[model samples]
Target: MTDSTAPRVAIVTGASGGIGRAVAERLAADGVRVVAHYSGNADAAAEVVAAITAGEGEAIAVGGDVADEAAMAALFDAAEQRFGGVDVLVHTAGIMPLGPIAELDLETFDRIQRVNVRGTFVVDQLAARRMRSGGAIINFSTSVTRLQMPTYGAYAASKGAVEAMTLILARELRGRDITVNAVAPGPTATPLFFAGKPQEVVDRIASLNPMERLGTPEDIAEVAAFLAGPGRWVNGQVLYANGGAA
Candidate 1:
């Protein structure tokens, strides 16, 4: 058991880049020891860990497929062995493949669901069973579920499953003092969002938000930090971190 006075520990999946990287850095800045989980980018993951260490914060990189049950279990074990125990799990590991449901290939749809839906279940299940009390589990969703934009059918469906699972898991952990929630971001300026899009299309989407700009990974990271720290009263909610888009 972790001493009450000890700093909290967190496992941030997909921490190799984008929102996950931002979240891991932010949490470490806030004095939380972080287990940075990456899928395949060892170099990128190591860079994140180096930055954290240079800043005098604690972090380690762990790589694995988020949907793999054994891998996820080992992730949890590593956090426990390294930092005493996990108090927060920010599951930012997912893929976004856009396609219309009518024409989307089954292979693509399956891959998206595997990473987004099954991945959430695998990681969250481990967190729920292993984390100390006062834990916070933040999953990722997308505002596309609300926007219902064309070509986002498969991605939105996967996130919808995420939102549903988040709510149910929160209730199921009743009285555990653990908060379960999801963060749904819209039109973020990440590499993932810019892929295959022209500048004009990107500009159009950015203008749709009331903020009149794309959300930075840091913007979304702020929400994750809050949920993992002082936002204990907030539970079973999907906090949309978009700049008022949708």
Candidate 2:
């Protein structure tokens, strides 16, 4: 049962699946009322809401394209109307369009940046504007920013922008008690990458990490939940939850 006076109200973008879905569920389980934002997957989002409520967590699914500024604004408006002001914002809405730079078309590159970078900025800006004093904002980055893998140039560039934004925002919100942080997870076993890849390629990618295993959505969610909840002293840090991988 949620207290009518609960202070933590979170908006989680790209919440239909993967890390977004996991974080939304985890935060709700932590007693934070969550707004699960998804672009088009209503069924999946409903499933997420069901899972959370079934687990005794409070959550609702909201649909909007994170890349659309108007839609994003509306998402926050709805969340605030339903659950009060936003207290935490988790930006997990991003695309990992991987391909060699030489082969990457402009359309693909722009699309990735649009969703990953621009969308992150939009939501983070909104969070800063409306977050209660001492709230948290968690952005999603990738270990590729450190590994600098060959085929991930464009994708890494987007996450790099996220890292820079998070750092600046942390400093900007220094006196407000709003800790800004990012999570850089290595090869996660999500349909985001594994579903379409060849078996051998997937194995090779997972084995690249020191852990010799793929990261799970739940693994990253655990770290994100910590940062969103109790890790106030851990400000301006990109918790690289890649299991010893770069």
Candidate 3:
């Protein structure tokens, strides 16, 4: 059994890049030993671990598909074998394919829901079963769920499900002492956000927020870190880290 005084262990999904990478590093800096989960990019995940190690932090890179139950079970087993127990789960692994609801093909919409909604449910279920008391489960949602953007139908729907699951899971945990919450980021400037978008479109989305600029990966990571650590009173809610984008 893990000692109460031992450092907390966190499993950060999608830690290979973007907001996930930043969250892994930030949590490690806060003295949480990290299991950096990657979907496919092993090298990028390794880089994140190396950076954390260089800063004298503890971390490991584990690769698995978020939507696969067996694969995710293996990931949890790996973390338990290495770090004793998991105290936090920052699930940032998801896909975003943009298109109008009517125009978007059924196949693509299904893929988005599979990765985003199903993925969140799978990991959150595993975390609920395994995480220790005082643990936090932070799932990723998007501000577009409220902004109601044109090309975000599929993505928004998936995230809307995420938000709903997060809230109810917190209540279900009841006496478990784990806090469940979703971070809804708006217009974050990551490679994922830059994909398939022109400069003009990017600028317009960026300007939708009062900050008048694209949010960095670090910006979103800060919110995840809070929910993981000191934000104990914040439970069963979606915290918008969008600089007033709503």
Candidate 4:
């Protein structure tokens, strides 16, 4: 069991941007030491670390491909070396290149699986091995899996595998007192969500939900903060943070 008084350590993968950045900042704000992991954006990762430090929060930037086992293992090492031990793992690292199932190229599908599926597996494996007993593992999924939207088949499929892993891992950690869950965000207002999307398409998707506006990275971060801290009982499930889109 972790010492409740000690600051918890968290590794937020993909912390350079989007929901990952929000989650990293939020956790740090809540007094958790953060390992901000980025795959290719060292400058952006530094910016994340800077913002956290500027806010009087503890954070460090680490760069690695999430699918690479050796790199991810080193990330855990750094967190342990810097913050004592890890207590939370928010795995928001993933890629979403939209294409219709029938027309999508095989290369794109493979890339999605490599980053979204295998990347998740590698990170979660390390977390399971290294996290303290009273920790949590939060994986990123998407409401697209439930929305049945066209052109989202490949991305949704990758997240479906994530959902499966989240459930089984929760059960697998029965005696460890750690919680595992996935957060499925819908139509979030992130650079990734806006890329290649026309205003009309974006408006149409936003309107599908009752809120009429798109979800923000902070909105998803709120749910992540809950799971990472007080929401201990919400295990083995995928909480849809989509503003009732599905």
Candidate 5:
């Protein structure tokens, strides 16, 4: 069991930008020491660390491809070495390639599965093995799994695997006292979501939700913070943070 008095520590993958960055900042603000993981953007990762430090929160930038098991092992090592132990893991690292299922090549499909599904399994397996009791494991999924949008077939399939793993892992953890859950965010205003999308298309998608606006990274971060903190009872569930778009 973790010492409740000690400051909690978290490793947030994909912390270079978007929802991951927001979640890292929010958890740091809540007195958790953050290991901000990034894949390619060292400069952006440093900026996130700087932001956390500027706010008088503790954070460090760690770079590694999410799908690489060795790199991920090192990431967990850095967290344990620096913060004593890991209390939470928020895996927001993934790739989303929007293409019609009919035309999506096998290569593209494999790449998505490798990064999204395999990466989650690698990270969560490590977390499950290493996290102390009273820990939380949060995985990222997409609201599109529920939305069932046409071009989202491949991406949604990857997330469906994530949802499946999340539920089973929660049960597998039985006596560990760790909560496992997936957060499925709707169209958030992130660079990834905006890429290759026209303003008109963005507007139309935003209007599908009753809230009538794209969810912000900070909006998703708030939900993540809840799960990693006081949401111990919310295990084995997928929380759709979609603003009712589906």
Candidate 6:
């Protein structure tokens, strides 16, 4: 339901690195005015905006915690002040830590839930209120929801909640012509994925997928681009863009 002829103003949260950065760059390249939202990395966020502006694409970096209302308010305000009303909201902010459920501390679990689950809710609620009638909202989930890998219980549970809320929110936006969807990626070769892993271990993990290599942030961003731009009929669907690995 996007106004395809008009410029789509998008707010990409957690855009400082990894999938988020890739999505912001791709959307800007596709002529979508982008607001690259980062939690604390102003430098990284500035770099993204600089790249876009250098290419004559419209972009700005807005710092805020996605789970905080005051911060999100400022984020939305900045988007309107910089461009206009938001037309696309892409929530790519998430975290995954490896620990068996038995060893997972309650504090760590709560923190992860707060960001992964509560942050999505916060962003979606704000986006639902701010986006144009024909806008689209994209949320992130992990293929672990389907794979059920060990040490992913808390993360998957949070995303499972995301899936539920996304569906219900679509119903709430019924006549608005807006669409809400989630993208669940498999093992991707972002910096987060490679961090602290031995090279041999990383290679072994990469080869497990049928693609014979780890997914690139660019690859996930392509799917995000489709959902954010031309993927109108993809309403309320959780698109698994994991190279058929799921």
Query: What TM-score would every model get versus the actual structure?
Result: 0.99, 0.95, 0.98, 0.99, 0.99, 0.96
Higher-scoring candidate on lDDT, 4 or 6: 4
Residue-by-residue lDDT tens digits, candidate 2, 167-227:
9999998678789999998889899878668999988888887789999999999999999
lDDT of each: 0.95, 0.89, 0.94, 0.95, 0.96, 0.89
**Candidate 5 accuracy as TM-score:** 0.99
Off by over 4 Å in 3: none
226 Cα displacement, candidate 2 (Å): 0.4
Pairs in clash, predicted candidate 4: none
Model 6: residues with Cα > 4 Å off, grouped in runs: 1-5
Better of 1 and 3 by TM-score: 1
TM-score winner between candidates 4 and 6: 4
Model 4: lowest-lDDT 10 consecutive positions: 1-10
lDDT of 1 by residue, 193-238 (tens): 9999999999999998889999999999999999999999999999
lDDT of 3 by residue, 1-246 (tens): 447789999999999979999999999999999999998899999999999999999999999989999999999999999988899999999998888888999999999999999999999999999999989999999999899989899999999999999999999999998999999999898999999899999989889988899999999998999999999999999999999988
What range of 10 consecutive residues in model 2 has the weakest lDDT sum? 1-10
Model 2 residue 121 lDDT score: 90
- Per-residue accuracy of model 6 over 210-239 as CA lDDT, tens digit each: 888888999999999998878888898898
User: Which ten residues in a row are the worst by lDDT in model 1?
Assistant: 1-10
Report the error of model 1 at residue 2, Å: 4.1
Candidate 3, residue 154: Cα displacement in angstroms equals 0.5
